[model samples]
Target: ECISSVSLSSLIAEEFDDFPDAELILKPISDGGDGFLDVCRFHFSGKILNYQISTPYDNSELICPVLYNIDSKTIYIESADLLGLKVVSAEFRNPLKLSSKGLGELLLKIENDVSSGKININKIIVGIGGTATIDMGIGACSALGLKLFDVNDKEILAIPENFNKVEDIEWDNKTFPFRIDLIIDVDNPLLGRTGAATVFGQQKGASESDIVILENGFNNIRNFLQNKDITDSSNPTFGAGGGIPSLLYLLLNAKIRRAKDFILNDLGIGRLKGKVDFVITGEGAFDHQSLMGKGAGIILQEFEKRSSKIFLLCGIIRNEVNKKLPDNIFPIEINSFFQNKDESILNIESGIRLACIKIKNNL
Candidate 1:
């Protein structure tokens, strides 16, 4: 699923080839992560609005896609398109310097377009995940007209590196004119050991010292919010997208929902519960973390509730963490056939097809 769109498509094609007479239903899912927009595009009829936006590094440009659904008057935006770690080079990846400003710019452009009658969007659903920054939404808030000032009454950029310098933050509610819904996969809070920077900063290329700074930055922002009477910083979805949902919840009154639940409800999965034979769900990797509120894990839970057999096809299976898989669940790992991660990903289609063939012949 991470390598190419062909992985899922190839899986479906092979599944149909294996069971020509059986009815096959493909429900591609994402945990509001990297592939979220693709899932939305496949299921929803929408027009894509492309705009030149800043990359996470703040030095380059990316043509970000926003899906505007005509039927629901909703606009779908994926944060990864703007601030994804993949957008930045591995050598230069640094959470301290990266910003979510591109996200803000996209939102502002959407709002302006709506205000000018260019689009009739009333709802904004932002898929927040797979981001590169740990600024706690400061870069995004700045783009939405939130001003941060230092002790000397000088304006400052709200990046993680400058977190300790921010003395005050200000914003105008009238700037944003749409109902915001944040789609999140994880339920970690905004503060503490399991919080944004502490849990995810290292993956975004933050060093040990950088993580300490990032933690302090998040704490500073938390303290600032506390002084403003926004004391509830322990919300479950706050840690998602580098605590972007937390800021959106505090400032924009955004509603939070698990991406799997939201997508399942939207796809009317409840109606298909008993009609389906078996459910096949997966992601790039399967591990203990996936069970902790991730989309694939949630899908597995749903299928289990319906008493359906489940097959998990993943690139890698962390046996140490995923040792307690359910009795009715079967896990297929493609790592055994390849020598390395890159090779495994490049040959994912063949690996999955082979796995399907074995399963079909065995059954």
Candidate 2:
């Protein structure tokens, strides 16, 4: 659950070697993020819906979940399926044209279901962390109903290679039974230096030229919205889904929320208010950026409120970051004692086992 496949697979192999004949039932765990989709499968009471959808790079199909939170009157959409880059190929991993239509299709499915059941929906919290393309928000709109036309009044088929070409949008959105809350994990703005195109483009294989194209396209989308007669949604969740949240804001007028809030409210974490003793967490890396809206920072903050003992593990712990750890917590860098020059997997496993051993000893 808290372990990556690389680390998990290797860990299993090591356990088998040590025991030689142990019969073990292995289970995976997630730390309240994308992993929750699989871990909480048994608890979900709604119908499981799957659909054929497009990727950010090329058109394809992805399967996803349509979670209905009855108590809160919300529909929870897990984005790990369609738009997550972990599933898309490198050549097909274009964030510039990534659309949340797969997500849209899921929500629309839920909407029809809930509507038929006559269940009132107050919110639609779309968890957008790992995604493939970055088409602002037009892809989802086009997939839904709105027509994104170019100069000739013909609909724009693929990702917007350039922004100046967008002519107009005709939205015939059916009256949604409820509002939408696009829960984005990152804080990058819609465009510019610290925005989506620049901050996340490189990881998704967008070059300097691609970033420029995406930025200019986003700008054009912005201009189109400003001139529209309807309400302006430029200031919405423009940071999520490579600014897809903001795109939804302008195109579909969705309410925005932090991913943290979605988890907090959904989990009712306050129930753990005076019951915890120690908290342990780990991640791929730790740095100054981890302090800003990252899962690590958020976990530490929540634990701090309870004055819980926190044990944190990471693949690498930079000197500057170690200086910021609070006294009650143990922050360990797996690299100090072990270094495998040839095998990164071995290095990661040694790190995890070492960190777990330290925590086990401490407890």
Candidate 3:
């Protein structure tokens, strides 16, 4: 349904309203992706501050929400709001042309706000997922004073298309005013068969030919950095968000934490009272990837031992992954209840309601 976890949890609770005898423990979690800011707002007392920033394509501006917690002196940012795949139109989903200038703009805004005494914060938590660009964070670094030059000493734009032309690089001398923490779910490395360009390029509108170019583009940057005596970023999590987090880690010393650990630290599994009768969780597509440190996987891991039964209601469920699930875990593909794909999407609410009814009948 493309809705927030808070909204989905509320909807599920309403569907099971007739079962008043049972207690509903709604714990909405985020694996540092689309609903990161919403999860923060749900768990913490904060005010949503809107800031105008450039979009991924940089052809327009977007107003993105930043969760500011004055008491905690922390700010939360969801990368999806700035450069997510969902934000870019299908026709304009070319990673070669996209720029993460908006993410840089947002960071600069926070820096300026802190320096001017407009806001006091000690930490910035960024959810680096769902990005559309794979420019090795060059677009973002450019906004922070990075400069790229060609062999002829001509300036080069910070985009994948120009990566091959880049011969020299310059970094921003300014240091960030606060600590930066990046939360990521995937474990792929920055460059390789399992890396960003190869694994995620197609989803970002990259063709087979485009993926080859993108891989070379990433290699150009790595070679440049290696020549400068910089340690290569081979960390698995560095691959998340089109290698954006990897660049941020090298350039800004941002700390990277797995989404599962981050969520567990914030909401421990032990906090839930009594034995849980049923655990209901969902995502857009439940597949092998979902088990790879995604929110749904974390939910399943934590509640499997505590709950009597777990309901995995997803829009589309891959049978291969479903077959590997535990006996007590029930996977319901919402589309099975509808006539067609379009009908399923249109009646998503009803599909979920019907799924809940089936669960109720079993109880």
Candidate 4:
């Protein structure tokens, strides 16, 4: 029911189309999830290479875009394109049967291209967010040459359903050809109350019983990897993308970076040399989590230092988060302008324009 950042920015721009003697800069930010590729395309002049990758639910494939910055020799990948929850149908959202195999396939394709001299690359930056599976990336590892076997030494598939059947894990010793940087949106450990399984499993359509299965599966695999000294579940960033980063960290030695840093610094949001006057940022909902490394919180922190007059607009704002706002930042909740929640979402375009109009009048 929420408007996209791009659409919101346009609405704001149209409202301030004739403002007297002022410049308007539109910067649409993403948490490296659904709109990651679009945001990358917006910021950088690069080639978009599309490849058919497997879907989250089955073996079928879809074309996903990969951004390549020629000058920096960096390749940006949005994990959600191949294995995001939004791509899967509501009925097929079960993590128990899903696999992250598509992600591995894409990575292998990129590696093959590099090895064949088709493209030049020094770093592969993956935005890991909004994934559907919680198999601890066993499925992806399988595609990348990680093998699993049962107690009888018989090999088995590396899916969540086969986790309990797995007795041994074998790595093909395949190393990534380039530096791997994983960008995570949330800071959650792989195992605990706020871990991947407990915190995000339900939203992916996992039931209470299914969550138990997933948590147990993750624990089993974690212990196996621990014996080999490949990975530790204590790292909070490992929880992003249903534990995909954990296995990547173990196998590819991927470095974990917060979305705030990657999106702001590497993507040029934090690299603006000139003085910025005003900044307007918002999210679908502003809550405690928004303050914890989310885009809006990071934007607030970044612009607060510049003494810019900031306006934080959101569909809904929690009272606790509102109280904690800085003195320079003004909070605008769209819901307050509507008769009810339904009306606000249905007429979100009007709500955004009204919010911007209010901001202009205040100035």
Candidate 5:
């Protein structure tokens, strides 16, 4: 069996081609990150509202996706459009300078559109992940009318490097007319060793020194919030989207939900229980991280609850072969078919087809 999530439509098509006679159900999945809007476009019949927003790196404009459903009075926004790493150039991928201000700007724009009768929105669903900043969402809060000041009572810019200089935060009393739901990809807390900055800072082009700065920045915010008795710094999923969820939870009273749960519930996956014989799911790479409540892992767990067989086919498997997995669960590591990573990746289509064929024959 073979399956993929997010950016693997071509791969899924190829798999279908190989098993033309087999009954296959194709469901494109996302953990509220990249490719979220693409999946939402398929499920929701809505108008695609486009807005030019500033990219994470500089003043470059990016056309962001906001789905407006008139029937449900809901709006869906993918955070990656404004905060994804891909929006920043490789040479300019510095988290310290990046700000999530664009996200706030987009939200305000949505409100304006709604107020003008251009769009009807009562609830805003934001998919938050694959971000390029570690500013603890201070940048976004700044745009949302939160004032950050330095010890000298001067306003401080909402950037990662300036987080440590924040002496107080003042709210502008601005409120959105719609309720907000933030779909978080990970369950990591906002601060600590396994937190956002420590785990994801490097991927955003942060050096060791820069990581420490981000960590300290996050700590400062946590301390400030805790002192006010507004929120607990140890909240899980607080670290998602570079601590975007934490601030949103505090400022907007947004509800944070697991991306997998949100997707499954929205799609009505419970109806498929027992009707489906097997479930196949995979990602670009499978490791301990996949088990960390990601889309694929959650899919597996969901199917397991239904007592269905599960097969995971992935480009690479980082876990040891001897590692224990569920009894009915089988993992097909496509990299094992080739001598090296390059060769395996180069021939991914062939590998997936072969893996599916092998699994079919074995069963």
Candidate 6:
């Protein structure tokens, strides 16, 4: 079993100390964003190339890379750099005025690097979560030259405090060298109760008043884009970083589908049916979000269809996955395993190995 992040690593140490004879071995699991790109290199015969882009918080610049598999005609980008909250401190974690410009820059860089490959950017599943900035998609559009200007025709750079005053939007992206498939993790609407403003705004540090401003902001941008014939599943950046999905749909013609479906179908998870005794997966949390549409939930559903045993391990699991959950699905939260923060996060490798070990032993 493999884990990711420091917390999982520490947990494994504790496990080793507790049960010296445990048969399982734990390694780290990282997406392309961190060390996983290197793991990818070690496991597969792909070349890792580097490019510089500002970190998500805009505090400094760093060189991150996209992995290319010449034989597969595919490129891999680790969005954790931009999406992960590690770059932002608690103060800046406030989504109000948080910018996703780094993400846009990263995407543009990938597009530039793939010039010689001649293969279209078919699949782009951004590991979305832990984002600090929530300019909806404004920061990203600005980085890509999709200008949103005020009535005076002066450039409106920062995310407007509220959407009520958005005057106009301009975009001329008729041609791009490649196509993109965006894998998203949520189903938040563009406005109102279930939308980004109502649900995620507060956690992002928006007050009640700020929520009003953000709601209006998202609506204004949604209107602006609609006028220009750029719209998406929700017509704005609703989910993943405040309307990032809608922005991708309009500007990039990307689809905002569940990440699990994309990964499973493309990776041929069905082909692996009955190949393994049990399956385990998870995310930051297991909640209503997982049941509606999540990579983990979808994977479990797929396994259910195949009559395979499925287990979920999460940092935290909601009392209910959904109002009506299937009988076969089982969720285990390893948070109960640790007595303190240091212990919980000690062996933390994103909790995958621990989750896996628990699942294995239980089965």
Top lDDT prediction, candidate number: 3
Candidate 4 to native Cα RMSD, angstroms: 1.9
Local accuracy of candidate 2 as per-residue lDDT tens digits, 1-363: 235533453464454455433343322322323544543343344544455555555556666655665665665565665677767777666565556566566657667767798556777666666666677766676667866679988877646574557888677754467787666666677877778787888877788888888888778777777777544434534756666777577656677776556444544443554566666655557888676666666667777668557777766767788887888778876656555423444666666666656765675
Residues 245-315, candidate 1: write the lDDT tens digits: 87778877888988776767875655677778777777678888888778778877778757557777788
Give all TM-scores, in the order shown: 0.94, 0.80, 0.95, 0.94, 0.91, 0.77
Off by over 4 Å in 1: 4-10
| Candidate 1, number of clashes | 0
Candidate 3 lowest-lDDT run of ten: 266-275
In terms of TM-score, how similar is model 2 to the real structure?
Answer: 0.80
1-363, model 4: which lDDT tens digit per residue? 277677777778888878975688888887776777777777776899988888867888888889998888889998888888778889899889999988888889998999999899999988888788887777887888899999999998777878877789899767877998888889888888999989999988899998888888788888888898765667878788898988888787788889888768876778653367888899888999888887888888788768458899998899987888888888998999999989999989889888988898767
CA lDDT, every prediction? 0.79, 0.63, 0.85, 0.84, 0.79, 0.60
Badly placed stretches (over 4 Å) of model 4 are 272-274
Candidate 5, residue 249: the lDDT equals: 85
Candidate 1 residue-wise lDDT at 257: 82
Estimate the TM-score for candidate 3: 0.95
Which regions of candidate 5 are displaced past 4 Å?
Answer: 1-21, 227-229, 305-308
Give a tens-digit lDDT track for model 5, residues 16-64.
5665455666677778888777777767868898998877767788888
**Which regions in candidate 2 have their CA more than 4 angstroms from the true location?**
1-33, 39-47, 68-74, 115-123, 229-236, 335-338, 341-353
Instruction: Please give the lDDT score for candidate 3.
Output: 0.85
Weakest 10 consecutive residues, lDDT, candidate 1?
A: 1-10
Listed per model in order, the count of residue pairs whose N, CA or C atoms clash below 3 Å is 0, 10, 0, 0, 0, 23
RMSD of each: 1.9, 5.4, 1.7, 1.9, 2.7, 5.1
Clashing pairs in 1: none
- Residue 110 displacement in candidate 6 (angstroms): 3.3
